[model samples]
Target: MSGSWRAGLLAEGVSITVTAKAYRLLRAILMTATEDDKMLSRNPCWIKGADNERTPERPILTLAQVFELADRMADRRFKAMILLTTFASLRWGEVIALRRKDLDLTARTVRVREQLLELEGGEMRLCPPKSRAGKRTISIPSAIIPALADHLKRFVDEAEDSFVFLGKRGAFLRGGNFRREAKWAEALKEMGLTGLHFHDLRHTGNTLAAQSGASLADLKARMGHDSDRAALIYQHATRDADQKIADALSARVKAERKKARKKDH
Candidate 1:
């Protein structure tokens, strides 16, 4: 089972579940083999599936780091992206696929309707957003509205559908250059911060939305998430508000108990 059939079953024609299983078995084999031989330089699991089953942790950024990255960014398009990422929590694909027309300056909202993928070679183009519900609008502050205006005046060109954040050579930004995750890594390092990722910017935005008293429904809309559950995960991820909620609940219960004791007295 660990030979050609296993390799073929883990190949492109294999089901995702089978590939996932292969990854788990492959990990065990490599670990066992490596523990026995410290100098062992290779693992044959590369022939079929991935080395591990775990997803990498997504990163987050602080507000200060977001501001720092925006300030340090030399390219105007890149700077715009940093701000939008921090503010809107839009995925890197969504932002890079954005068109000038996707914004409504009057309403102070941006439509996240599409996502871009970097294919083999240098080709890139917009597909739909990650999910159907991922196509939604999110409000921006007036400050961002003006900033976008300035950006459009200075950077955007061609037509209304032209990419708002065109690379200097005028193409969709490659994911290797960015994708929220990679950019967060770059920005955190640049700003002298540690252990943050671009996806954390989305988390930061979710935390901000929650702190601003946005309802779960509202947060979902703002985040362009696919479900209420996904938005609620932010409420779970954000510790401060949950702590505040716990504190408030304890106060109410304690006060009631104290009042009851006083009445009996």
Candidate 2:
């Protein structure tokens, strides 16, 4: 049955990723039913590498490129939004959900408490973050503070509970609406980053943090990842730091050899 389904999907030109997910889901359901019926001692849906799907590497922008992209954005609110996501490693939902009360300019911290989830039919719901780690307090860079302050002064409502970022109509900022009305695509095009997604800003920030010698725990906390696997991606991204480690080891060896030679003499 699995083989026939796979063949059918292939013939239908379904993507491997979609086929893999469908098979995985089907396997789980069948296995669970079989277990309940005492038809099998264990799940027999094991397909090698089925669960280890890999997507293409996400594009990451440098700090300069991030600022360039932000500057190119016509909306000043978006400029602050871009900077916060890149520097604070915030997700799109988290950034859009920010309220005046969440930010503390005096302490330069942003408290991530909840997210504004945009459901179908333009309905918005406020919910807790994606994970426990998602509800964290992140320190903003001093450079970002000025822009955030300016944004608050000009764009945000004076009330603490009011949303920090809103559409021109003062409605919740939906991803689709922002992409269309804010000219996000055009900004990317002007920056020569046509295919880059907004989430890549978080990726860039996490990679930069890892390269700056942040520990695994720190990376996990900053990226709001519940698992080590995601944090390890940033560790892998810091190949230049690996080179620096090699150079330091070589320098230590050279220093030890020189000391030994001098003592022998």
Give the alpha carbon lDDT tens digit for every residue of 154-217 in model 1.
Answer: 8888588888876667766764344343354455567787645445566677777776777788
lDDT of 2 at 188: 85
lDDT of each: 0.69, 0.81
Give per-residue lDDT, candidate 2, residue 99: 95
RMSD of each: 8.3, 8.7
Tens-digit lDDT track of model 2 for 1-265: 5666664553332445777888789888878778777676766666666544465577788889988988888777788888898899988788889999999999999889998886756689999998998899988889889899999999988999999988878998876677766688898888777657767788788988888888899989888879998898788768666988999999999999999999999
**TM per candidate:** 0.68, 0.73
The CA lDDT at 44 in model 2 is 61
